[model samples]
Target: MVTANKKKIGLLMVLPAIILFIIMTIYPFAYMIYASFTDLDLSKANTGKIIGLRNYLDIFKDQLAISSIEFTALMVLIAVPVEMVLGLALSYLIRNLIGEKILRALFLIPMMVPAAVGGFGWKMLFNFIFGPVNYFLNLFGIQSIEWFGRPGSARIAVLIVEIWQWAPFVFLILYAALQALPRDILDAGKVDGAGGWKLFLHIELPLLRPIFYVTLLLRVIDVLRTFDIVYMTTYGGPGSATSTWSFYAYKVTVSYGWNIGYGSALCVILIIVSAILINTLTKVLNIGRELGLSKE
Candidate 1:
């Protein structure tokens, strides 16, 4: 009876937060769904009406939207895998080195910085005429390249800043996972003449695989929503060349376009895509079982 009462007390304590979530999150999303089917231009708020699937269909016709989708996809595909691999490698590299604790903290400095600030700093660092990067390149007999002037270089610059900021996040999580492994199991592998890469491949990799998939899924979801960095650094230009779906949606809804209905439609599409990707990844990784997310 005491245990059951405690459970009820706990539920009662959390009841307010549950209600707040419904008010704050559920209501807005439900409204967004209603708005997406309308021609709800913010410029003439009261003059809008439902327009069926036109807002969604119009997405393909917009060149900027198409480019933004492509750019967002490119970032997810490139950044997540690279960060995961690089972070895993760094975690292994610093496992037992002298002053490893200090080194780990130092490596995490970039991750600690806010994304907008980091992007702005990188923007200055990559300045064509007088940036430190160009000065260093000059020492190596390379010409100062215009990072922001060209679309390709601007995209690359954004990618580099993202990788620099996020790789440490991946490293921290993976390193913690690596440290939490069973020492006794590792010692047994060492006893069986398994050292170096051999031990890692056969034993450590299998043990670490679940955490890796979880991290990969996290990075994918995060990179898909990247916007702050692009906004700070490139402002979604070299002429909208580096615009992300999130940034573009913001533009359509609030910033430049003032088309709330269209932006809501774009947001709905993004949400659907994210749901599909997350569901697929969860099933393929079988992470639900690993994370005890399943009743089984």
Candidate 2:
């Protein structure tokens, strides 16, 4: 009776949170899905009529939207792998170094900064005339290049800012994972004439695989929804060259278009794409079972 009562009490305590989740997250998502198929223009008198898949079809027909989606994909492809590799390499190299804790705190500075602030700061550093990046290039007798002038250069500029800001985040997670690895297995490998690359590849890499699955998923999702840096630094300039999905959606909804219907549609597509990628990655990595995080 006591156990049953305690269970009931626990359920009662969690009821409010479950209700709030439905209200805040579930309902909104359901509504957004519905809105995506409607002509939900706030500016229009006749709106919210179900149109069914026209919005989805229009996404492909729109060049700017397609370009933005492509740019976002490119960013994810380039940034996630680079961050993963760079982070893992740095963590492995310095896991046993002197003042490791201090180095960790220092490394986390970029990730800790507010995204908007960091973006604006980077904008100044990349300024063509007197920015420190160009100033240093001038010192080396190289001409200062406009970071955001051309399509290709603008994309690279956004990428550099993204990689710089988020690489440390990957490093932080992997570095901790490295520190927590079982010393017994490592010692056994060393005793068995396994040293350096052999020991890491066979033993350490396997142990780190579970954590990598989590980190890569998170990093990819974050990149997919990228907005702050592009908004602050480039403003989707040089003829919308560096625009992202999130940025484009905002532009449609509020910036100039005021087409909430199309914006919602854009969001729905993004949500669908995100879901597909996440599901594929989870299955491919088998993260749940590998991490002992799933019940069945």
Clashes per candidate (backbone, < 3 Å): 0, 0
lDDT of 2 by residue, 30-125 (tens): 988888898899878988899999998999999999999999999988988999998998888876689988888888899999989999999999
List candidate 1 segments past 4 Å from native.
Answer: 2-15, 289-296
lDDT of 2 at 31: 88
Candidate 1 residues 161-239, lDDT tens each?
9899999999999999989999999999999999988988899888988899899998999988888998899989998
Best by TM-score: 1
Cα lDDT for residue 193, model 1? 99
lDDT (CA) per prediction: 0.91, 0.91
**Cα misplacement distance, residue 140 of candidate 1 (Å):** 1.7
Taking every candidate in turn, the Cα RMSD to the unseen true structure, in Å, is 2.3, 2.2
Off by over 4 Å in 2: 2-13, 292-296
Per-candidate TM equals 0.93, 0.92
Which residue pairs show collisions in model 1?
none
